[model samples]
Target chain A: MVQALIGIGIVYIGILIVLSLRSRREIKSSTDFILGGAKIGLILGFMTFAATLFSTFTLMGMPDFSRTHGVGAWLFLAFSDAVMVFFILWFGFYLRKRIGQQSFRGMSSLLQDCYQNKGVGYLYFTAAFLFLIPYVAIQIRGVAIFLLEAFPDFISVGFWSVLIVLIMLLYSELGGLKAIIYADFMQGTLLLIVVWLVAFNCLDQVGGWASLFEKINESNRALLSPPGPKGLLTPQFLIASCIAIAMIPVTQPQLSTRLVIMKNYKSLLRMAVAVGTFAMLIILPTIIIGLYGALYYAEESTSGFLGTVLLQEQHPIVAAVTIIGLFAAAMSTSDSQLFAMGNEFRGLLGASKEDQLTPVRVAIIVFAIAALLFSLVSSDELVLLARLSFSGTGIMGPMIILGILSKKPMGSFMIWFSALALLIFILSQLNVVPQNIYSFRVDLALMILLSLGAFINYRLKK
Target chain B: MIKNWSERKLKSTWRIIYWSAILLIAVTFSPIVLIQDKVDPHWLQMPFHLWVSILNTIVLVALTGVGGYVFYTLKSKTDNDQNL
Candidate 1:
């Protein structure tokens, strides 16, 4: 197992290094580095978008969620993903048209242009930094913990966490967004293949589909039903999750940037549909593995269940490749987000265009270090943490919609409202405030308030 | 027929497509489609919630394809008008 893991890791790193080196040659200006000269085409666009959106969270978090939450996990992600992809189609068109008129930069810069205020830009960047860093950190922490379980006593989990961050920073600094996209292509492909392979093994272990569900039903009938055994997938939770996740392309910088950089609107539309299809295909396996876990490893620790199902039960070479795939999943997602953080900060900085690149790179490194520290100190439930990032960032969705849809500058009031909403959201997540109001999550309430505020504010303005 | 429509007409059509698509998406996942509690009448032996989720995916995919087709046709017509 050790030998196979080392071998696959070296090969994976080699491919990543080569892709970054090639990407380095494409770096002519900050535009080229950040948006790949805004000329990315259909295939690369879809793959990168899919890759960035689905990550270690999909690979590690989804199965566990499915195992614990029951069938409602499907509605939590796969259904929400379907909704988000359609939103991508609608938003991508508007974003493509707007970006064509104005040059491309980070989402923060675009919001700044829309609101005609530097403060709006800073507010957007601050929200991203606050929520996305923990998101990026948890991605590292998730795979690192899995890696430690796979190779116990060899190195601490923190070391593995730092190692992945270092890998992300090295390639991102060298090649920029293009490098990250290229890495995403690799990661996305490996994830699809590896997840399906693991799912097949799990299915075989449980004696196939019918048997798997039967075993789960026999153990806990709720696992075979809605809201699962934990009852975490209520209607409100599903609706709220759909709202939070569907806004991702509008609110998340990394994904929003991809929408603008596509070669044309046709490609963007195609990518949207392709991503929806990919979401369905990719999540199918996680359900299988989750069911397998529900049947066999229901009470086992997450590490124990994942360790056995992912590694110990699989062939050594397959186990090694799965490890590499998880690392790829983590790196691909983290690099895009970490790099977006850099771009977001760069937009906030009033530096000269020529001097901006270095500062952004430095900011990315600082964010990476902060994420590494957080990874060491913090461990939490992956799906909820990921959803927190989504919901936190989703608060900015109305602001982004206003920016994309309207030609005129928005009121600074919307910016302030969004920042306040983000604060309340973070507080709720931290348990500083109760997490729900009238059976709806706090983030859902904030989403409603922000959306209403955006609508009324704009309507009153006109 | 859409090809002969005015630009404003075409724009209105696109707007309709966009909102209707959004509505379709919402309905598929929302409680309106199927409540979660009932477990009878399994399709292919899959549970009610699970089948509904799968059905939602397929329905969404079809809606997206239809939406894409409308937009593509309209876009091409508009592009042709620009060239002429």
Candidate 2:
């Protein structure tokens, strides 16, 4: 399994390099690089969309959470989200229409129109940039650690993180989004193939569904467990996951750009269905792996295969493979993020547009290096940070959506909602008095409702 | 002023929306308000994962269907009438 995993990994890389070469001709301008001349079709858009959603945290962090909370933990993801899939469909169409002729940063500028406040737009953009750097670094390290775990002697985690970053930087600096998408299509296919293989093998190892459940029940009878009445599924958490997944197309800048490139309503609709279907399907293997991990290995002890697989005994060859798959997932996300961030920030800060691209690429290199330093220094915080960093948009989702949908001119409301969301996020992190979930929920809820009101009022005024 | 056709359409839309809201509220309060005495209220008994999945699937399918109908049927109807 290890040798085969390595062989397959090599072929995946080789294919991407070849595809990147084919796309080199298309990489001249920043526009060509970032938005792919606004010509990205459904396949690239759908794959890129799929790739961004598949990340290390889903592979590792989710299982980590499941260990403590059981199947009910997945609900933390499945429910508690309300924006619904409306955002997904709306995003592909609305943003595509809104972003035509605009540079990537120009899209953020449109938030000024929605929020009716340039200041709020600027605040949102700045927060987004600040949040992405650390998030990108965590993803880079996840891939690196996967390498370290898989081939302990050959490449250290830090060394592998840098290597992954360089590969990403190379393709990104060459053609930007054009290069990235071509690579994405390649990586996404590898991911799909690998996930399906691991899932099948793991299920076979666990002796199919009945035996799997038998093992789970035998392990302990807890409701949601064998004895538990709740079962493995959680309704509230599923609702949250659906909400987050629906919000992905809107809140994720990298995924949202496809809207700008999509030629028309038909393309947007096609990509939405394609992306959504692929996303839900691709995670099946990871979810199965996660469920298997609960029934097979101890949670914290199985964080990676290094100690259990290499030192004590055979943990599971499939686990070693899943770790690599996870690495692929994380690396794919990091590369695209680096590319997108480099594109946007380059244009924002560089003396010229071309210079912007250069700095952004350099920044990605810098970001990866910093992550390596931190991982070596204190990886605990950095490793767990991606899932938390994901909260930035979610923190502002209700308020931002309100601005988007408001019927009234809400130039002033943007600042209030921005402040409110920021307050909710900060207060949640501070762990002060009350220390209750509602502190975060009520504040976030307040922000969402107020912003919605502002938006409706604005629309009504017209 | 809006015509009789538009007025009737608005009235029916509101009617549907009100009924939907009532049904949703019933669903939301089912465990607590209606079945409070019957349902088990324990961390041990919370079927959080299973029911959430079922509800999410339901809501997801409903949202997609309603969205499809609105854009395909209602929006097009509005556009067609304007053209006429």
Candidate 3:
């Protein structure tokens, strides 16, 4: 199994290097490096966007969540993603129009132009750095843990974590964003294939889908219903999950960047629908794998359960492919993020065009190191941490929306309010402040208040 | 005034459909509001909640397909008119 995994890993890395070398010829300027020349068509756009949105957490966390939380896990991701797709459609239209009005390089610069204040750009970058670094760390941590479980004797989890980050930086430095997207197209395809293959394998082992659920019902009825037996998927929890997930295109820089760089609105629209379909197809398999775990490995630890299902019980070859798929998922997600951090850093700079790419490259190396350190100490709750990243960055969603939609410039006061709201949310996450007010989650409440303040401030100015 | 009103109505029609679809899906799948209990008549051996969630997914996907089709048709028409 280890040899097969290493062979496949070598091939994957070889392919990434080849793609980087091929794309490097096109890297004449910062714009070409950062935005893939900003002319990506429908098919590549859909695949890259899907790959970036769904990552290691979806593959590893969703099944574990479903196994523990019941079927409501479906609503947690698939339905929430559906809602997000709708928002992307509308938001993309407004965003494109806004970008047309004043061309900007990245989200931070776009916000700066919209508000006519540099502070807003800094605030956007601050929120992204605070929320997104840990999110990237969790992706690295997820794959590290999975690999450790698969081959405990191969190397330490830290080594795998370091290796993943190094690979991301190497290719990203060599080929830039074009290499990342092409790599994403390949990663997304492999993830979908291996996941469904494992999912059906689980079903076959459990007799079939019908009998699988029957076995689940017999053993644990809660796995079939809301809140599961653990009560993790309550209405409020799912609602909060929906809001956070829906805010991805509005908040997450990597995803929002993908939305902007598509060839045309027509392609964006097609990409939106394609992502919705992809969301359902990718999540369906996790449900099968989760239920299989619930039925058989109910008492096992997470590492133990996943190790058994993903490796011990499966054929060695399947296990090797699954490991490669996991690596692909992690790299596709983390590299996009590390690259986005570099892009956002460039936007923050006032440097000349010729001086931008080098500093951005240096900043990316710093970001990767930060993520590696965080991965070493990060929690194992992949889904929860990812959600926290979503809702934390969601603090800026209303700001972005108002910026895109409003004809007039927003006040500097709005940026202060956004900064304050983000501070409060971070405090709540740290438990320095309570997370709920009148039964509403702090992040959700802050989002609504800041959004209303944005609208009201705009109205009063008018 | 009449042209403005017609255009406004046309635009709001899609908004209305969009919101209604969202509401319908949210209501059907929300455990606190509906399907709070596991019941009989399971489809594909999935419980009622799971069944309804899948059903809602289908509806959402269909809605997405329709929305894409509408955009595609409108875009083509605008292109043709511009060419003329």
Q: Pick the candidate with the highest DockQ.
A: 1
Q: Positional deviation of A199 in candidate 3, in angstroms?
A: 0.8
Worst 10 residues of 1 chain A by lDDT: A347-356
- Candidate 3 lDDT, tens digit per residue, A1-462? 888878987998899889999889999988788877877888999999999998999888888888888788888899888888877766877787677633346789888888888988899998998899999998899999998888789899899999889887888899989998999999899889888988988999999988998888788887787877877777777777787888888788898889888887778888998999999999999989999999989888777888889888777788888888888888888989988878888887864653468888898899999999999999888888999899889888888888878888877777888889989998998899998978887876887798789889878876
Candidate 1 lDDT by residue in tens digits, A314-425:
9999899999989888988998888777777776665456335877778888999988888888664888889888888899999889876887886788888888888888
**In model 3, which runs have C-alpha deviations exceeding 4 angstroms?**
A101-103, A351-355, B1-12, B29-34, B71-84
- Which has the better DockQ: candidate 1, or candidate 2? 1
The model with the greater TM-score, 2 or 3, is: 3
TM-score of chain A of each: 0.97, 0.81, 0.97
Per-candidate Cα lDDT values, in order, are 0.82, 0.53, 0.82
* lDDT over C-alpha atoms for residue B65 of model 3: 63
What TM-score number comes out for model 2?
0.77
Top-down DockQ ranking:
1, 3, 2
